[model samples]
Target chain A: MDLRDLWAESLAGMLARPVRSALTTLGTVLGITTLVVTLGIAATAGNQIVGRFDELLATSVTVDVPPSSRGPLVSWDAPGELRRLRGVVSATALAQNEESSNLVVTANNLLDPTRVFGQTLAVVAAGPNLPETTHGRLLAGRFYDAGHVARHDRVVVLGEQAAAMLGITRLDHAPAVFINDRAYTVIGIIGDLRRERVLASAVLVPPTLGPDFGLKDVTRVLVATQLGAAELIARQAPLALSPSNVGELQVIAPAGPRRARDGAQDDVNGMFLILGLVSLVVGAVGIANVTLVTVMERVAEIGLRRALGAGRRHIAGQFLLESSLIGLTGGVIGASLGMAAVVGVAAVRQWTPVLDIRLALAAPVAGALVGLLAGLYPALRAARMEPVDALR
Target chain B: MPEPVIELTGVCREFPSDPPVRALSDVDLRVEPGDYLAIVGPSGSGKSTLLNILGLLDRPSSGSYRLDGVETTELRDGARTRLRGARIGFVFQSFHLLPHRTVVENVMLAEVYGPHPRRGRRARAEQALEQVGMGHRTGFAPGRLSGGERQRVAIARALMARPALLLCDEPTGNLDSRNTEAILDLFDGLRAQGLTILVITHEDGVSARAGRRVRIGDGLLTEQG
Candidate 1:
């Protein structure tokens, strides 16, 4: 028979037992739906996770420079070239007061702030915009200005914890602390850090004070960037800053984007793909059971067709086509359902849906193949029936 | 005289059992073109077995059966199916109509699964329905029809292919006397049109309507004078 006749005949048979056909098709629908939803959501979720990773992790790069005893290790204006690069939001050079490590601090020049909360920590030399560049909030009092740095003012701003550690919480007294027998006024307190939490334990000073403490060179440069620009900045930062001694600078960037994306998708697809296959096998078994029952129920009809001159192969072909048609219908419905589920989930979670076109296109064919294979034994049994016996 | 449309020689059909029951024994039969014949028998008399062999629905053990000069007993299963499709029309006692389809569609099934091109299938099916006097209810499903009407539709389905033989087993078994007389009249008209017809029935009145009659009993057959 031609394609037209074969399809028509199968369609008629399927329509004859509409309830049975629908029930049998449900298995394939669920199976294919699982597969499509699994892959689609993997792509969608993978894309969203990578986006977050880029935002929080890839955008922050820290370039650490080692300390040197030979004059100065890095220029005081080392961030000038890096700050001009695209995607770089802010860059700054910083120096810690290593010589003041053992010094005691007290508010209002008290021998020791007996109210509590005190520690002997290093003092840091910072620029005028240190609080802003470091993503810290000023809780009380104002930070020192450029006039302080240019005039070599002996002013200080305690970190959040440092102020508390010194038992000084208020700015009303215009608190002053003595280090190495020199008095410096605490102008402000900085806290709520976004970049570095370790900065909270340190006090702040002008860069000019570094020379007196033998802290002539800065320790590290911190650079904040736009999303997805870390790799490029990591590659170009060393070249831009002291190209002659780029080896002494260490640029730490985020993990590779391609590797992260693959790692994410493979993890999602691998776990769900096995579950989807199991569902599909269950669907195939359901089809085989339903098709075998249908064959048994249609014995008299089969005898009639055989008596009307249908060959054994024709009998087999009819049942096979019936099952494949059922599978095709299920596949179409399941694929649509899977796509809708993915899109709906993405919409609910506010994620951009990423669907693989090839998976969508192949689901129906795979369902039909599964159905065809499942119907083989049943169709054979139907074909091998004896016309006289079936009629009897 | 034209060569017989069906010929059976030394035909024997035996069911394999612990006791080996013989359904038919060395039966010889011939049916020529335009012949109207009936074989009358009680239940279990082997008349239906003979009809099955003639209809190519069953094979006769140790026999040579030919349909339209084709050696059918030696033919392959596929070739037998093709031959049956092209040459034989069957009417079962139970009115074996596919209840899901309309009467006209049931008739058109002659070419639905067969090798015949579907070019003029509908027209032939419609004409065949008219021939069986079922034209008025062409669109009705077989389930909605009366027993006689359903049988007529089945007959129309058989006739749509215009086979060389019309083989009916208990054609009027389920019909009332009124419907049976009408069917017998239609059969008479068809025989007058030079169609070869075979009717197998246990009813004496049904067999008496045919031009030739044969009696089958205890696996043997005898002709009526």
Candidate 2:
């Protein structure tokens, strides 16, 4: 038979049992839909995760300055120099006195003469840009600036937890916290530290009081860079801090987010792709089963065709074409449904949907291939019947 | 003087059962162009076997059967199928009309597998339907047609390829006397138009309408006077 006639025959055969054909196509639709939905959702979710990662952990770089025998390894003004480098959003130097954690702090020593409110709190001295470097917010008052550090003023910023513990809520009356019996005015209360979370429960003071607090040298410099510039900034921060002794400062920068994002996406794709293929396999089996049943049901028709002089290949071709057409139809429907599902879910969840154009185009062809394979056995079986036996 | 449409010599067909049943035993037959011949026999008389072998639907255990100058016994399956499609038309007792198709579409199916050009197949089908007086029912589905009408449609389908021979097996088995008489008259009309015809049936009335009749019993054939 000609191609046109073959196609017409297949179509007529399918239309003969409309409900069965539709049910058979449904199997392929589900398989392709799962494939498109999973891949699209994985891509969108992975991008969102990487975006959040880039905003926080991927941008922060810390340079740890270990204690050196040659006195202070990093100068207090080294943060200002590192901040001059490209891609650096903010940089701050921190010094913690070894005995500051052991100091007794009191909210009101004069009111409580028995020292009933004394508590041991860590005191960390930082540069003027501590709030910017740590991505922290000031809950009340203001942070100490360059003037406070240069003039050696005894002003401290209380961390959220520390301020609560010392019963200092309002700075209206110029609240003071005594550290080791030395009174220091509270300038600000800093909270919500995205980086250096340990600072949330400590007292932050200017670096000029490091010697008085027994902080011998600058301990670390916290640097925040622009997204995708963390690794470059990490390498350059040590050289910028102490050009002569860059080896003394250890820089800790997070691994690139691209690799992590790809790994996550691959894992997601692998898992869902298998499920899609399994569903496709099931759909293929459904087509095969239906085609076989159709072959069995049309035995007499087959015999009549043979008597009319249809070659075995022609009979097989007609059945194979019918199944493939069904698969193609299902694939198109499934691809559309899958994309719609992805977009719908993304819309509901407020995510930007991601779908590959190639995948969309390939889905139907893949479905057709599945149908072709599924119809092979049944078509062969139909073709193998002798005209005499079939007619009988 | 024209070549015989069918020539069968020493044709034998066997079924390999536990006892090896011989369906057609050394049956020899010949049919000329424009001939209307009938092979009549009761059940298990090898009538169907002879028809199957004549239509190239079955192979003889040992024989030489030639159709239209082609040694069909020596032909490959594809060649045999092509030859059959190009030369022979079949009409079964049950009509075998596709119920889902219109009468015209059923007629058109006859040329679908043949070597004929498909460009004007519908026109030809309509013309053949007209020849069998089923032209008016071209758009009607087979389910809506009477037994006589359905047989006429089958005849129209068989005539689509302009085949050299029309083969019928119990053509009026399911028809009432009136429809049977009508079908027998149609066969006579087809024969009058120079078409060779072969009918396999046990009915005396059906065989009496043919120009020649043969009797077969227990895998053996005998020409009737």
Candidate 3:
């Protein structure tokens, strides 16, 4: 028979038992739907994770400076020099006095008998660009800048937790905190430190006061780069800081975001792809089972066809075509349902939905292939029956 | 002298049972074009076996049978099937009409596997239905038709390929007496049109209507003088 007639025959056969055909096709539909939804959600979730990684960990680079006996291991102007390097968005140097943690910090001095509060907090001196490098914002008052550092102004920025402990909420009256009986004006309260959580509780001062605080060496340099630029900056920052002692600075750059993203995506894809395939197999089994049962039920019809001069191949072809058509139909519907489910989930979760066009295009074909494979044994069985026996 | 529609010589068919049952034994038969012949026998008389061998649905264990002068015993399955489709039409006792299809569609199925061109198949089916006096019921499904009407539809299907021979197996077995008479009359009309016909039946009344009658018993065929 011609392809057109074969297709018509298959359609008529399916229409003859609509409910059975639809139930059989549901298995394939669910399989394809699961496949599409899993892949789409995996892509979207992987994208979201990678985006967050790029924004925070991937862009931030830290260089630990070993203490040196020669005044300071690096100059106070080292941050400015490193900022000129390619991919460096912001750079800041910090020097922490080793004994600052031992010093007692009090919101009120001993002379004030009304309120006496003391706490031992680490004191860190940083460059004027500390806010930008730390990915922090000044919640209250202004941050100390180059002018304040150049002038050696006794000013300090309180970390969010530090300010809370010091009982300082606003800068309306310019609160003063005493460190070892030396008072310094709190210029700003910084919060939302994305890179260094330690900075959220430390007292930050300018690098100019490092010597006064017994912090003679610049301890570390914090650098932030653009997305996908952290590794390049990590390699170049040491050279830019001190050409003679690049090894002295240990750069701590995060692993590549692309690799991490792909790793995460692959893991998700691998896990859920199996589930999709299992569902698809189940669907294929359903098709095979229904096709087999149909072959069994139509023995007399098969005999009739044989008597009407259909060869074994023609009988087999008709059945195979019928199953494949059912699978193709299920695949289309499943793909559509899966995509809709992905979009619906993403919408509810407030995520950007990601879908592959190629996957969308291939789902129906895959379903048809599954159906074709599933129909093999049953079609062959139908073809193998002796015409006389079948008629009997 | 034209070639006979069928020629069988020493045709024997055996069923391998615990002790082998011979269904047909050294059967020889000849049928000419435009001949209305009947093979009458009771059940278990091997009449069905003879019909199966003649219809090319089964092969005789040892013999030579030719249809339209072509040796059918040595033909491959596909070639045999093609030959059957092109040259022989069948009418079953049960009518064997596809209940899901319209009368015209059932008729059109005859040429679906035949050597006939597919174009204008519906027109040919309609013409065949008209020839069998089932023209008015061409659009009706077989389930809606009476036994007689269904048999007529089956006859239309059998004639669709313009086959050289019409093979009937108890064609009136399921029909009432009136319906049986109607089918017999239709067969007479078909035979008058120069169609070669063979009918297998157990009913004496049905066999008496044919021009030539043969009785089969115990795997043997005998002519009725």
lDDT of 1 by residue, B169-208 (tens): 8999999998888888988988998889999999999999
Candidate 2: C-alpha lDDT: 0.90
Worst 10 residues of 1 chain A by lDDT: A109-118
- C-alpha positional error of residue B119 in candidate 1 after TM-score superposition, expressed in Å: 3.2
lDDT, each prediction: 0.84, 0.90, 0.89
lDDT of 2 by residue, A129-234 (tens): 9889888999999999999988999999999998988889999999999987889999899998878887878888888887777885899889989989999999
Score candidate 3 by DockQ. Answer: 0.60
Cα-lDDT of candidate 1: 0.84
Q: Is the docking of candidate 3 incorrect, acceptable, medium or high quality?
A: medium
- The candidate that wins on TM-score is 3
Measured by lDDT, the strongest candidate is: 2
lDDT digits (tens) for residues B1-225 of candidate 2: 889999999999999999999999888888999999999999999999999999999989999998988889988999989988889999999898988889999999998897678898999999999999888999999999999999999999999999999999999999999999989998989899999999999999999988899999999999996
Q: Pick the candidate with the highest DockQ.
A: 2
Assess the local accuracy of residue B24 in candidate 2 as a C-alpha lDDT between 0 and 100: 91
| Worst-scoring 10-residue span by lDDT in model 2 chain B | B111-120
Please report, as a residue range, the 10-residue window in candidate 2 chain A with the lowest summed lDDT.
Answer: A110-119
Candidate 2: CAPRI quality band: medium
**iRMSD values, candidates in order:** 1.4, 0.7, 1.1
Better of 1 and 2 by lDDT: 2
